[model samples]
Target: MLENLGNRFQDIFKKVRGHGKLSEENIKEALKEVKMSLLEADVNYKVVKDFIKKIQEKAIGTEVLKGINPGQQFIKIVNDELVELLGGTNSRLTKGVKNPTVIMLAGLQGAGKTTFAAKLAARLRKEGETPYLVAADVYRPAAMKQLEVLAKQINIPAYIDEGNKDPIDISKKAFGQARANNYSYMIIDTAGRLHIDEHLMDELGDIKKAVRPQEILLVVDAMIGQDAVNLAKNFNDKLSIDGIVLTKFDGDTRGGAALSIKSVVGKPIKFVGVGEKIADLELFHPERLASRILGMGDVVSLVEKAQEVVDEKDIKSLEEKIKTQQFDLNDFLKQLQTIKKMGPLGSILKMIPGMNSDLGDLAPAEKEMKKTEAIIQSMTLQERKKPDILKASRKIRIAKGSGTDVSDINKLLKQFSQMKNMMKMLSSGKMPNLGGGMPMGIGRGKNKFF
Candidate 1:
């Protein structure tokens, strides 16, 4: 998502790698580039200034690592600062001491509050909590219906008072309902306006006063850049937001909101909305996000996502298949679907160490993967299990069935053969050191067949 910023910083690091030692002048020059990159990424100017200042101070008189180059040292300093700019550590949801923890969602209109509420409900459900979704946004027409639809999708119970326009009254009644029903958590989706207005503030403030919520989370659109920071500050000044939720981070955002909101609003980003899907919400982790922004990759998050989707039994079966070279087209297609469930290919690849850089531009990779998936899906079960049976005529027929050309089919088959060969080598303990030939690894290596 921060591809532009990542690429710009990568170029800066390449320049610093040529220098033998960090001189004051050279360091300043490098920081200048870094500053430009942040500014271009729409990061807050003051945030950028303070961040660069921290890196410069740390870079000066810093003892270089034994085997690390000056560039790597500079990268380390910047990475640490980036982590600080985003929250330094994970901020978790606060639980209410008593039954039914009340979490009030507040934000401007179109900030995805309702959707995030549903996502939170689903997340809590996954964690074995009985969450009751309260549709308290009585002012907005269809707001209650939206919450109901999402609740139904997630199989969570929703409490709504459609006729009641008073949010505070609805919330009070919903609290009573939660108590009677023994719900562990109560999520109140408050109304939002097109812009911050006195009336909206008054309504939210009254609801907060009446409910005394354990968490007042401000849902913000990450693509709004610095406006998100100002909006968060205003909300925190009034209702005192306990945490922030940055939404739509899966888009091509410059990441300004994520970097600036916490420092400006004095609240941690408790969660982030990565996609529109109900399952796309992720807990905010500063270190992992820092690694992502610097192109260092987040292996921990990668493994966690894999564990979530890949069952232990499935992994055992897949391991057996890999060991026996029985990973045929049917198994391959299944693996592709499993990977698709984890998220976008580019995002998944970014979690692998050094794979982000090795992929270069991922648009082509994503496109090619989609094409391969389409072709595989179009094949018959027999064809999938025994791809060797597909002769030239069959290849043409499959291409037509997949709405692709014969050459496209040939390209996929070739790539599949190469991938199978690589898998065999990897399983047979015959894989070569990729660095011996490929400067960046994989795509240009001696075994760059894939």
Candidate 2:
């Protein structure tokens, strides 16, 4: 998500590390590059200034300059400061003492308030809360319908008062209904204007007054750069927003909003919309983001994603199959599906410690995996279990079914055979000959093999 800015930071660190001993001048030069990169990423100028000042104070000190590994020390200082600048810790949703915690979302039009409301509702539901969605965006004709559809998709209850145009009244009634229904949370999606206006603020303020929401979150389009920070400030000034939610965070954004919102608005980024899927909403973590930006990877988040999709029983079964050399095409296909469930291949690889900057175009690799999956799916169950039984006639038939050539089938079988042999060797405590590189299309190539 912050690929551009992250690449820049990695390059700057590489230069700093090239120096055997970092002089003050060398450190200053690196910091200057860092400052320019932050500004170019559309981070707020004042935020960048304060951030650089903090780094300089720590970086030029005797502890860093006299350290055995000055370059590593400097990088650590920058990472620490970056984490603090980005809120230092994750901000969780606030729960009220009473039943049905109310969360009101506010933002300008096209900030993704409606979608984020549904995403948040789904997340809360996954956490065992009976979340009720309330669509109060009366001015927007489609907002109510959209919320209804999303609520149905997530199997959550939604209150859409199409007959009533008063959002404040709609919210009050929804709150009463949610409480009566014994809902754990009620998330109200308030209306928004194309630009900030007194009327819009007044409507949102009235809804907050009527609902007495436990949290008032400002959803912002992260692609809007510094304007997002300013918008959050304006909303906080008028309505006193509790936290910020940066939507479209997966877009080709320079990452200005996420880096600047906390510093400018004095509110933590409670959540970020990574993708359009109902489950794409994620709790913002400052330390994880800092690590990602510095090319250190986010192993904790990657593990969490894995744990969510991979069942314990499935892992045990797979391990047993590999041990017995029975990890056939069926198991291979299932593994592919599991990886796909974790998210995009490129994003998953980026979670590895050193894979961030080295990964070029991953589309070819992703396409190859899909092709392999299709080929495997076209085979019969017996063929998957006993791939050696596929004669010329069967290969021809399978090729036609999968829309691939016979040679493609041969390559897959060859790769699968090598993979099995390698697994056997590993299980026997012997190192397989990796001189031929990884099997399948996993080796380096012009097409950027999977």
Candidate 3:
């Protein structure tokens, strides 16, 4: 979603680079471009106006830092303002001091309330908290069953009183069950309803009063653009929500909701549903998102993602293989499998500095990874461990089995050999440019498309 915005910023900065000392005209023209870019991104017009005003105020009289051009100085100013406009800091979900903390989720229909509840539970479960899902969404067909299935997949307990149609009754029983079972927290998945539905609002109000939840979160669909801002306002006005959970955050939405919700609703977005997987929810960090929007990669989020899915045993084994100079096709395939778990390769690379826009334009990263994996899988065990023994005849057989030409195999071998050599140098304490060595089409400085 930020791809276009990043490209726009890059273009504007290139134009700014043509100037030695930025004049008032130069600043005005650049700010005009920035304003247009923000408007095109679906940001609130008032927010854009104020954002541009601040940037112009700071950019007009700012002295360029030593060794930095006016373009870079302007980028810094924009980055700072973007950070502030994006909430200036991370808003973490607060854990209740009392055990069995009740957290109720409320939102409009089709806003992913049930799904976000399960995602939140799965995330909390990963953090060693005993989270239980409460299926109080009695209105939606199969909503309870849906929550049950998701909980079963993650091995988390779920409370579903399918016989009871009253959401209030279900919520009361779920809380008791959670407390009786010694659970740390209970996430109540309430029924979704539009803000205009007074009957549904009364039902939600009854549930809130009965449960007295410590946290009332609103699950919002981020794809609705400007309507998301209005939805948040209405929900906040009625429920006085503690924070927000944005679903479909990884979609191709214009990102106006994320940029506008906080300012319009005065509520921080606590978490974002980044993917469809149960483990794909992420804590929302305003500063990191601002950085990504400005074409700077979010290294912090990348590291956090790595920590979540990385296996210590696999890391140790891979290190041993690298240190012994025995890393081969099998290890390479294993590495690809790990990357797959880390989410899409394109999404991952976008988090690395200077690699913001390489994936989509340069190559199909996910397909390349899959193709590489298939090629590796087709090779015999001996061939994977010892590629030197593969002669021309064997290459032909392997190529046929892997559904590729001999050239693909040869290219893979060449890249593998280069990677092995680079690993050897790194083991001996030499830092080299990774841009030329990345497996997929990920690059930074003057590298060809993979």
Candidate 4:
């Protein structure tokens, strides 16, 4: 998820930050490194060119050359340009002035179109809109069933006509059903092909003609890299997409597509699919993304994910436990699970300030966490609540249950105990400088607690 690019940019920034002053040669070298990074990420060549050009123009001026903090100033300019390239600001979901705004989903097959449809419906539901899902993908019966399954899981109504093969007819009927039922939104999940073809295009065109949808969103795979840009362009050429929804962003994508699509097709990326779960779709925020690309992290997004999964009551209870030193292995396990519910470990780690820069790559960290979680899950409730109850025999049993050696469990328990001690110290006001020392346990550079 732009980890590679973020690392490269961070390294370059470090060199500039180390210098007491900025020179034209150093600035040129830094820009050159940035250009190469963007190109290596597969960002659209034109976009890269324009971006570097803008940064150069702003960076070489007197304001930057004579700035109090020249290195920070240069980074700021690049950040601003990155934000502009990503989309100047957040583009929100469009709701129709009239009832039941129709949002048509368009994309190639296996782009997670059906799943994204369900996610969108669920998101709108949270916003007080009664969204009715229309399974208009009549080409494949499985696609319709998938939508139905997702709809049922989310407790949303899915309008399906399995007997009908024509999507236009199904869509028209679905709209009528929505109107009759007083649904506030109609999300039509249309059919897609493995690749762009005239038959699929014509069918989608017909559906559009019949429904006159207010928003036509193209669901693209971020892992496709530059091809995503091409797909968005083709779709926008034919259907004029109002926005894009990038799926699988949490995958090990270079993030070229997300950066290139909007600039190439002139469409705002409305949402991003960060995980496989139905609750993973997030409304895209360009500024947060800009911060991530520059290795500044996205604390706002991290907090939002935490809020979504951790109820206020749970938070208060956890706080009380931390203050009283009652936070045990059970509470620790619950916190781990809560973080996992937010998303993958790597994605979550990048949201913490300075973590993304220091963790060379988080794939290894994620794998280690999974192993630790497995060991924790193998323990009994009593053992989890009170770690001291685990002696040699219990450790061996837990190790056998978790498919790990005793040492692995020992290390995890030790780390958990240390973390609990730290939390207790902080809560009891015994560690006033804990935040300054650790910085959320991510950043590098002589930060002992981190």
Global lDDT of each model?
0.85, 0.89, 0.83, 0.85
Tens-digit lDDT string for candidate 1 (1-450): 677787778878887775667778778878999999888888889988999888988888676788999889989999999988898999999898887999999999899999999999999989989999999988777999999999999899999778888889999999998989989999999999999999999999898888789999999999988889999999999888899999998887887888888777779999999998999999999999888878888999999998889889988998898888877888877777888899987688778766555456556656666777888888999988788888888998888888888898776676567667777888989974444442112364222322
What is every candidate's alpha-carbon RMSD to the true fold?
A: 3.2, 1.7, 2.5, 3.6
TM-score of each: 0.91, 0.96, 0.93, 0.88
lDDT of 2 by residue, 160-270 (tens): 889999999999999999999999999999888999999999888888889899999999999898899889999999999899999999899998888888998899999
> In candidate 2, where is summed lDDT lowest over 10 consecutive residues?
60-69
Q: To one decimal, what is the Cα RMSD in angstroms of model 1 from the true structure?
A: 3.2
Q: Could you tell me which 10 consecutive residues in candidate 1 have the lowest summed lDDT?
A: 438-447
- TM-score of candidate 2 versus the correct structure, residues matched by position: 0.96
Best prediction by lDDT? 2
| Candidate 3 runs further than 4 Å off | 18-23, 361-363, 426-450
Tens-digit per-residue lDDT, 205-292, candidate 3: 8999998888899888888888888888887888788998889998888888888888778899899998898888888898899888
| Per-residue alpha-carbon lDDT of candidate 4 for residues 1-450, written as tens digits (9 for 90 to 100) | 898898898888866664555566678889899999999999999999999888877766435445457668777888899999999999987788877899999999899999999999999999889999999888765888899999999999999778888899899989999889889999999988999999988989989999999999999999999999999999999998899999999898988998998889999999999888888899899999999988888999999989889999999998888878888777877877897788877677778777775555556556666677788899989898899989999999989988899998877777676677778677767864445334324335432221
Q: How far out, in Å, is residue 167 in model 4?
A: 1.3
Question: Whose TM-score is greatest here?
Answer: 2
